[model samples]
Each structure stands twice: as C-alpha cells, then as structure tokens.
Target: MCQRMQMPIITSRYWNMVHGTNPKEVQQDAEGMQVMQVLGNNMAFGLNCKNVAMKMGLSMPEEPEFTYTNFIH
Candidate 1:
C-alpha cells in the first residue's frame, strides 16, 4: 500500500514479522527482535535523511491524480 502511494518503504534484514501467541513469546524471539531493531534504525535513518533534504529545499515530487478501475464492473 505504501508503495502504491509513493511513500518510502523501510526494510530490515528479514521479513518484518514476529511469531508469537503472546507478548512474552514474542519477546523470546531473538531473531524477530533483531529484525525489529534493524527496522527501527532504518526508519530513523530514512527520516533523518528526509529532514536534511527538506532543510536544503529538496522536496518530493507532487502526486498525480489517481484513477480507480473496478474489475467487477
């Protein structure tokens, strides 16, 4: 969805998901925790870069009008 909207997508070392039936189980997933940390860092870095660019007068391109097509119709 973000890609369709031309929004930046942040990625990590693996699929952004954690397997758990509860909070405690999730906390025990070492690999998932690492992925989350990487994702957080990536997001922070991307935001910082965007902020610096804006400060320098750089901006994203204007979005074009979107057209929706109904397959059922």
Candidate 2:
C-alpha cells in the first residue's frame, strides 16, 4: 500500500518486532532495537534528501488525484 503511494518504507535486516512480556525483556531484544535504529536513520536520510531537493528547486512528483465511491450499500 505504501509502495502504491510512493512513500518511503524503512526496512531492516529483520522484521521490526519484539516478543516480550515485560519492559526488561523488550529492552534486551537487540535485533528489535537495531531494527528501530535503522528505521530512524532511514527516515532521517529520506527527510534530508527531500529538504535538499526542495532547496535546489527540484520538482517533487505530483500527488495523485482520485475520487472515492461507496461500493457497498
């Protein structure tokens, strides 16, 4: 769904999920923490790129136009 809208989806070496029943357990999940860090870095990079492009007057893609309709009554 995000791909369809041209949005940047941050990815990591593994799924961003931690299986823990308590805060301490979650804090010990190294992989999950790494995934979160990677996601944050990616988000920052993407935002920086957009900022630079805007400063350079690079054109951003136009938003898609659409109409919504009710299919079920």
Candidate 3:
C-alpha cells in the first residue's frame, strides 16, 4: 500500500509484533512495545515534516513514470 500510494515506509529497530494471546501478556513484551513506539514516533515525524513543507509552500516531487506489463501473457 505504501508503494502504491508513493508514501515513505518507516521502519523500527525491530518488527512490530507482540506474541501473546492476552492484552497483559502483550503489554509485557517490552521489545514489541519499544518497536511500536519507534514506529509511532517516526510516523509523527514524517507527518510533521509534511505539514511544515506545506506551510512553507514547498512543492512535492512529481510522480514517477509507471508502466504496466502483463508478464503472464
């Protein structure tokens, strides 16, 4: 979806996954929480940047040329 929408994908120090069946157990997963926090922070940073750019009247980059091919044919 990010690729399709031309949005930058933010990555964290670790994959965002909490291996637990319950909320308490999931919360106990410290590493997962950290990763989620990182992801959230990155997203917030991105949004802030975009907002600043808009406020400064900065233009967005042009969309790249896209070509579709039917490989199955």
Candidate 4:
C-alpha cells in the first residue's frame, strides 16, 4: 500500500524554491509533492517514500513531525 513521508522543512511556502514543485500531496495520491533537493515538479520519491514512511511508523499529514499513530497491520 501507498503512504506519505517526512517532508523537508524547506517545504514551508516561504522556502519553496522548486521551479514547478508542488509539495501538497497527502498519501501520494497520484498528486504533486514539493521537492527541494531536486529540481522540477515531480514525485521525487514516489511509492518508495510510502515504504520508508511505513518503516518509520509514519503516515499522511505527519503530525508532531516525528510521531505516528499506532496503525494495526
């Protein structure tokens, strides 16, 4: 299954420098996500990001930044 990941602090609207990047997607919903380290507007990590988030016990709309609710698998 797909999911979300830890977005960089640069994602804040004030720091958005990615040419056409739009980091506003939740759950990698085939939507756009802001990429700072990389140029161009695209899904930088794609589903791989979801995997990482899962491994890290993360989910969409990362609240408390580094915290995740217990989701039963």
Per-residue C-alpha lDDT of model 4 across residues 1-73, encoded as one tens digit per residue? 3434456432332343423334443325332234333323333555566679769987577345356778898
What 10-residue stretch in candidate 4 is worst by lDDT?
30-39
For model 2, name the residue pairs that clash. none
TM-score of each: 0.83, 0.71, 0.81, 0.23
Candidate 1 per-residue lDDT, tens place, 1-73, comes to 1223276899999999987999999999999999999999999999898889879998677777788988995
lDDT, candidate 2, 1-73, per-residue tens: 1213366676766787876799899889988888888877887988898889879998677767667999999
Lowest lDDT 10-mer window, candidate 2?
1-10
Better of 2 and 3 by TM-score: 3
Query: What lDDT does each candidate get?
Result: 0.87, 0.77, 0.81, 0.45
TM-score of 4: 0.23
Which rank order by TM-score, best down to worst? 1, 3, 2, 4
Best by TM-score: 1
How much is 35 displaced in model 4, in angstroms? Answer: 17
Q: Candidate 4: lDDT over CA atoms?
A: 0.45
Task: Please provide, for model 3 over 1-73, each residue's C-alpha lDDT reduced to its tens digit, 9 standing for 90 to 100.
Answer: 1223376887778887777789999899998988899999998998898889879998677667878989996
Collision pairs in model 3: none
In model 1, what are the clashing residue pairs, if there are any? none
